[model samples]
Target chain A: MTYCLGIQTHQGLVMASDSRTNAGMDQVNVCRKMHLYIHEGERVFIILASGGLSITQSVTTLLRRDFDQGRGLASAPTFYDAARVVGEQIRRVGEMDREALKRDKISFNINVLLGGQIAGEKPHLYLIYPQGNPIQATEDSPYLQIGESKYGRPILDRGVRYRLTTLEEAVKFALISLDSTMRSNVTVGPPIDVVVYQNNDLRVRRYRRFTSKDPDLQRIQFQWEHSLRKAVLELPDVDFDEGAEQVI
Target chain B: MTYCLGIQTHQGLVMASDSRTNAGMDQVNVCRKMHLYIHEGERVFIILASGGLSITQSVTTLLRRDFDQGRGLASAPTFYDAARVVGEQIRRVGEMDREALKRDKISFNINVLLGGQIAGEKPHLYLIYPQGNPIQATEDSPYLQIGESKYGRPILDRGVRYRLTTLEEAVKFALISLDSTMRSNVTVGPPIDVVVYQNNDLRVRRYRRFTSKDPDLQRIQFQWEHSLRKAVLELPDVDFDEGAEQVI
Candidate 1:
């Protein structure tokens, strides 16, 4: 289980993911889910993976191998082309592992949020399905999330708008969404990785990892709870007016 | 597909449920999920049901039949007995229909959140599983929700506390939770039925229905969205300080 999110804003893009991996309750481990590929001033691609740990790891390992052999994504001309190469690599990994996993009653599940920019392309975001197909985020639906997504969706539905948000605001909302997901779901634990890509820069601009003890994360949670309680109080209270006809 | 919740608070209990039922997209219809049986000063029992429509309807209809025949729930000594009867009734329905449904590849799946009070007894709440087993809500976890629950859960995790909340506050939180669930999920829809049982009253004290066209329902959702956006703005913005050290 995991939680990963990607958002495209007017000013840039933001991606966030938790690091916990669990095959079962007794076998929990921490592994980085956010992988970065950067070519300095030329291009950058950030992949946030979720689902089977072994499958995602295999896909990432093969991707790295592709870069090592200079045969795939490294030379793709645009973000769209890079997404295709990533999709192809995911299928390659699935082809190699799916039959073995099926024999064990295990699934070859994997989902990836691939986003970043090429030198001449706009920053783009794509959600690649386990079947190796992908869908790009558009202005109408400017964000995508994978794994344990519902617990955090209400906040995004109410707070985010691609045309209205600045890069900084997107980061704030992404962190808050991740915070809500982490609190409600045990599978998505700490050591959250966040990256911000400034539009037109064609490179990664900011990245940080927050652990359980991070003061800033704690403060965010505290302030959110405090203001939420206060805000709830400001909402109109129910009056219980319907019982006049049948009061006991 | 449905969403229903019951909350226990210091002042009383609040239950809210959406009223959508669908066999498929084209078959969507309005059907209340909240059921009430009030015996004036003697007792009151509320049931919020979710899952397979046929199964829930059968269980509910059978319970009504039992009460009509004076063979169950209505003559039970306490809320616990009534809950047991409800569970027994669910299992009875499954016994009668499970095999016939299995022929069509249909599952005998359902869940129920039951809560209320009997005279001389404290308020009680139970979650009855499809297999007819039941678990009561305790002080440590004072709420129970069935079906499409996750989208609305984070707010409850951050807001509701049974030890301190007034009945009015519980109603507000339940409405907010329902609103969030409805926004994120299409399977759960309006006309919502809400009931409030004030502790020691031994009967329901409030009841109301809100449809999609209901002005009050819209007002609640509008104010919630407004307050939530304002709350997000009040939180401190994320500073992109990590990038100076790791720029690519």
Candidate 2:
């Protein structure tokens, strides 16, 4: 299992992915799930993937092989076209491996969060499904998440707004969301890969890898625990029935 | 879909369940998910269920049928015995319906949280699985949740301590957990049934149903949104390379 999130905010796009992969509780390992495609001055694309590592790695290998053939992401005409190329690559991999995977009782599962900026287009984000189809984030739904998404979705629902205007703040918010899930679930862990893209920028401006010992994240976790206790205590007590005292 | 949580604290136990039921989005309706069985001074048992409504309702009916036949919860030798009774009831229902459900390509999915006090034993909580087997909550693991549980599990993981000594605080914390999930997922909604049982008291003292229009809940929701925004803004900004500014 993995947890990966991508947000397209007014300021730009932010992407974060956890590094843990597990077949079962005893069979867990670290594998970086974020793939970076950059053409320094012309374009930059970050794909955060989750699900069957075999399928995603095969898709990545296929994409890299195409790039080696000189039909890379940098040469694509638009972000949409690049996304289409990525989808085609996924399809190719599926065609080659899906049957064997099914025979082994394994799923042809891989979901990707693709976010990037090209020279002439605005920064955009998309959630690519296992079927190779994709959904772009809209103003009403500015975020996309895959794999162990439920634990972190509530924060995005209540806390994320279209008005958030800074990429730095968006990054912090994304970390907090991930922090909540990390605390609860053992399946998701650090080191986490984070990339921040600003509007109209054709490259990733800020990228960081977060480990469990990161001081900033420690502080955030501490503060969240404290604030939650304080918040719960502040709520008014429910009125009790007349004989309620008898139970205590 | 539904969301229900049970927390065992120093003061007693807190149990809450949502009222939503749906075959699909268009077929959604409200159905009470919390069942209370009290024999006044002898025993007090609360069962919060989620999953197939028909299955859960059938289990409830079976329990009541047993009670009517004089094998009631109050007559159970222990709280553990009561849980076994509940599990047996679920098994009976599953036996009756599993084949039909399978024929229609439907799952026999059902999960329940059972918690309360019996006359002679300490308060206890158990999470009953679809297979009818159950696991009791321990001091190290003081809570159990079912149905749409992932979204709300983080708070209990991060903030719930055995030192939490009051039902008021416990219920408030549980509500906050539910609020987070309800905001993120449309499948879970109000009115929510909340029940609190005090330690050594063989009766439920406080039970309330909350709706979206509840003023106190609205205030807490507003405050949570406010605090999360403030928390995000307080994080330090990520420093980036000079050339990176052009891309973001």
Q: Candidate 2, after superposition: displacement of residue A136 in Å?
A: 0.4
Which lDDT tens digits does candidate 1 get at residues B214-233? 77777778888888888787
> Residue B183 CA error for candidate 2 (Å)?
1.1
Q: For model 1, how does the per-residue alpha-carbon lDDT over A1-248 read when each residue is reduced to its tens digit?
A: 89999999888889999989997899999999999877778777899999898899898888877866766768888788888888998899889999999999998899999998888778899999888888999988989999999998999998889899877778778888999999999999988889988888866668888888988888878998988878777787655555725311
- On TM-score, the leading prediction is 1
Please report the candidate that would top DockQ against the real structure. 1
Worst 10 residues of 1 chain A by lDDT: A239-248
Residue A218 shift from truth in candidate 1, angstroms: 1.0
Q: Calculate the i-RMS of every candidate, to one decimal place.
A: 3.2, 4.3
Q: What's the number of clashes in each of the models?
A: 0, 3
